[model samples]
Target: MITISVTGMTCGCCVNKVRDKVGALPGVTGVDVDLADGKVTIAGITPERTALADAVAAAGFHLAD
Candidate 1:
């Protein structure tokens, strides 16, 4: 599992969008969005960091450090 700190996820819709986008990526088996903490956990075959970041960005959110 990989935990990413995401910003700009303020509601259920945002969470859902993030989940959907990230979950659609290849090798992504599971995704959990924590709106309260602005975090997302992805469990899968281990995607490249850049790919993960791009997916998050494409979903209209920021993957924080």
Candidate 2:
């Protein structure tokens, strides 16, 4: 699993959007978004970090370092 911090998520809708977007990416088998902690945990084959970031950005969120 890979855990990435994300910013700009404010509610359940945000969580679902993030989940749907990231979960749709290739090689992503699972996605868990923790709204309170601003974190997204991804499971399955790890894609490139850039791809993950792009997916998150496409969902209207940013990956935090």
User: Which candidate wins on lDDT?
Assistant: 2
Kindly list the per-residue Cα lDDT of model 2 for residues 1-65, writing each as its tens digit: 99999999999999999999999989899999999999999999887889988999999999998
TM-score list, all predictions: 0.93, 0.95
Which residue runs does candidate 1 get wrong by more than 4 Å?
Answer: none
At residue 8, give the lDDT of candidate 1.
Answer: 94
Candidate 2 differs from the real structure by a C-alpha RMSD in angstroms, to one decimal, of 0.6
- CA shift at 51, candidate 1, in angstroms? 0.8
For residues 1-65, what per-residue lDDT tens digits would candidate 1 score against the true structure? 98989999989999998999899889999999999999899998777878888988988998897
Give me the candidate number with maximum TM-score: 2
Model 1: worst 10 consecutive residues (lDDT sum): 44-53
Model 1 scores a C-alpha lDDT of 0.90
Clashes of 1: 0
